[model samples]
Target: MIDLHAHSTRSDGRLTPGALVARAAEAGVTTFALTDHDTIDGLDEARTAANTHDITFIDGVEVSVTWQRRTLHVVGLAFDRGNAALTEGLATLQQVRRDRAKRIAAKIEKLGVADAWSRAQALAAAGQITRPHFARLLIEDGVCRNNNQAFKKHLRPGRDAHVTVEWASLDDAVAWIQGAGGIAVLAHPFGYGFSAAWRRRALAAFAQAGGDALEICTGTTDRQQEITAARDAAQHGLAGSAGSDFHAPEQFWLGLGRLRALPGGLPAVWHDPRFPGADAAN
Candidate 1:
């Protein structure tokens, strides 16, 4: 099976890159991509592990994007990790994330977590303080029960710990991925909870901005979400991609390579030879 999206300790995930690849290999994932959030630091380790397991590793990143003031993710696959454009672009976004994380820490401080940033940093392997780190801190401090509750009660918009950071634009994100010889895919097209009309407009804008595909089958998607994303991909002339969005073993529903296949009549992302492991995937 082919899973075009997942994460590791290089980002918010629980496993190391090697462990991630080992697990994917065990799960029969022939084509795997470690699309960590705004970073490619784990690619070397992941690639080495994939080589050992005979699994094809695709250089990937889930780029954070702000479209019309709403945060969304764009998955870049089969990219050159050394390309200056993509490297520098992701670095810029990394700083943006750090700043937002600090702001979140400041907000959480008011809720009596004085060392919020420090605590969150301790949990992050690379010092990349993500919202999940904060969520973990909240859980440890008895602020929330779980990841979902942490986001809903503390971190999401209108919450006390919420902090909004303006991420890269759609055009720039797509350009960075393409410039690095990668395919830019809209990640989880329906997960943002936008209205149907809004999703249509956003999908059109993504296509116009040169996005190459959309995830028609994501880890968290239901039948309605999959069907809608597939229709959106077709209407915009984009390819269909499947991603588990796997972060950790605890998130069982998003186990490595656990995503459903694309619905009938949709063109898969690996249909293009440029996609990593397309030969084996097809």
Candidate 2:
């Protein structure tokens, strides 16, 4: 099976890129993508390992975009890895992410979470120190009971330490992916808590923005949610995509390629003209 959405230590994941690829191979994943958050440093190592393992490695990265005042994640698959525009855009994003991380650290410091910022950064080992890394540190240091507690009490948006800044628009994000010779797929549509009407509107907007596919199956979304997403994709004429969104072994529910099957009646978004195999759709 193909698991297109994954993470490694290049961003927030626990495993190194090579180890992540090796684990996916052991999990029976034949086609995989290391779509780490806001970074492609893991891709080179993952690609090398995929070659050794005889697996197909689809070039990917998850780009964050702002739409309608909310943060949305868009996954780019099979992009030209060396495209200058895409690389420049991601470099800018990395800087923005670092600035935001520092702000979060300062906010937590004011909240009397002593040394949490420094400790978290040290734990991150010079990689991107995400809110999750902070949350885990808080949990380990007895500041919070667990990762969820850390976020719920101190780190969620509009709370004390949340500081994710809007860096790119949805249109520009999709355009970058397409311009880099990739297919842009909306990641985990329901994560934003959009109403039915809002979802329809967003899908229309995304399609117009050059998005090629919508993730119909991902992580542990239920069958009903899958059907809902599949129907929405069909109505909007989006392609179908699936992935595990896997991060670590502790997240056993998020096994490689673990996803509900797409409802059979829908026209796959991968069949859209933007995909390489679009002609086979007919």
Candidate 3:
């Protein structure tokens, strides 16, 4: 099985790159992508572990993009990590993330969370600082019962700790991915919380910007949703991609390589020339 989206300690994920790859290998994933949020720092370690386990590793990154004033993720797969355009773009995003983290910490501190910034930094452990780290710290301090509660009470949009930062534009993100010899896939469209018309407009904008695929299955058991995504992909002349979007081991519903297969007659993202057996029919 192939999993085109995942994370590690390079971002907010719980596992180190090596451990994440090991888990993917153990889960019978023949091909895996380490699409860490806004950073490719974990790719080297993941590649080494995948090599050791005889798994095909795809170089990838999940870029945060601002589309129609909303935050969305665009996954770039099979990219040249050394490409200057992609590297520079990611550096810019990382700086924005750092600033956003500081703002979030400040806002949460005003709400009576002592040493919030320090706690989040400590939790991150030299990895990228993310909202999840803050959420985890809140949970540990008994401010919230779990990650979901933490987000609901503080981190989600319009909440106290929600710091809005402008991310790269969709066109720029897609261009950076394409410039780096990668195909851009709109990650988990259904997760965007947009109306059907807005979703269509977003997809059209993405396709116009040179995006190559849409995620048809993202570890959800909803067969109807999966089929609808596939139909949308076909309608837009885009290939279909699947991923678990796995972050932590406790998220059993999103286990690696265990996602439902893409619907019949949909073009698989792996059919791209960068992957082996690309010539084979999907």
Candidate 4:
């Protein structure tokens, strides 16, 4: 199977890079991409593990972008991970993430949580700090019953701790991915909760901004949505991509290599010349 999006401990994922890749190989994933969020630090280790396991590894990163006032993710696959421009841009984004985490901690502290920043940092353990770390801390501190409760009470948008920060624009994100010899794919279009008309508009803008593909099948098993996404991508002259968006092993439905195949007759992102032989399964 071909799975184009996943994460490791380099970001918010539970598994380490090597472990994630090893699991993918064991699960029969022939082509795998470790598209960790806002960072490529795990790619080198993941590539090494993939080599050992005889699996094809693609250098990938999931860049967060702000479009029409909503945060969206763009997955860049087969990129030059060491390209100077891409690295510089990602550095800027990492700084933004750090600053946002601090702001969120301060906001939640005002709501009676003490030393949230330090606690969350401790939980991160040298990895990049993310909202999930804070949520875990909240659950540990008895502030919330679970991760979902933490988000509903403090971290979700418009909540007390939600701090809005401008991320890279869609055009700039697509440019960086293209500049680094990668294809920019709209990651999990259905996850955005946009209305049907709004979804079309966003897809149009993404295509105009040089996005090359749409995620026709993500972690979800909603066949109707997958078909609709594939049809829309084809209508917009964009290629189709699929991923499990796997993060933790507990999310059984989204286990590595478990995604349904992309709808028949849709052009595949892996079919590009840059990824020769990757489309063999398709």
Per-residue CA lDDT of candidate 1, range 112-230, in tens? 66598777887886737888888888888887889899999998888888987899999999999999999999988778888989888888999999999998887888987898788
So what's the TM-score on candidate 1?
A: 0.96
Give the TM-scores of the predictions, in the order they appear: 0.96, 0.92, 0.97, 0.96
Clashing pairs in 2: 238-269, 239-269, 239-270, 240-269
Q: Rank all candidate structures by their TM-score, best first, as comma-separated numbers.
A: 3, 4, 1, 2
Tens digit of per-residue lDDT, candidate 2, span 135-203: 886677677898778999988878877886887899888888889988899998887778878887888
Question: What are the C-alpha RMSDs, in order, of all predicted structures?
Answer: 1.3, 2.5, 1.4, 1.3
The local distance difference test score of each candidate is 0.88, 0.82, 0.90, 0.89
Predictions ranked by lDDT, top down? 3, 4, 1, 2
For residues 1-282, what per-residue lDDT tens digits would candidate 4 score against the true structure?
888999888888889999999999989998999998889998889999999998888999999999999989999999887888899999999999999999999987877678989887877775788888888877877888998899998999999889899999999999999999899999998888889898888899999998999998888849999999998999899999999999889887678888888899998999987664655745
The best candidate in terms of lDDT: 3
Q: How close is candidate 3 to the true structure, as a TM-score?
A: 0.97
Clashing pairs in 4: none
- Clashes per candidate, residues 3 or more apart or on different chains: 0, 4, 0, 0
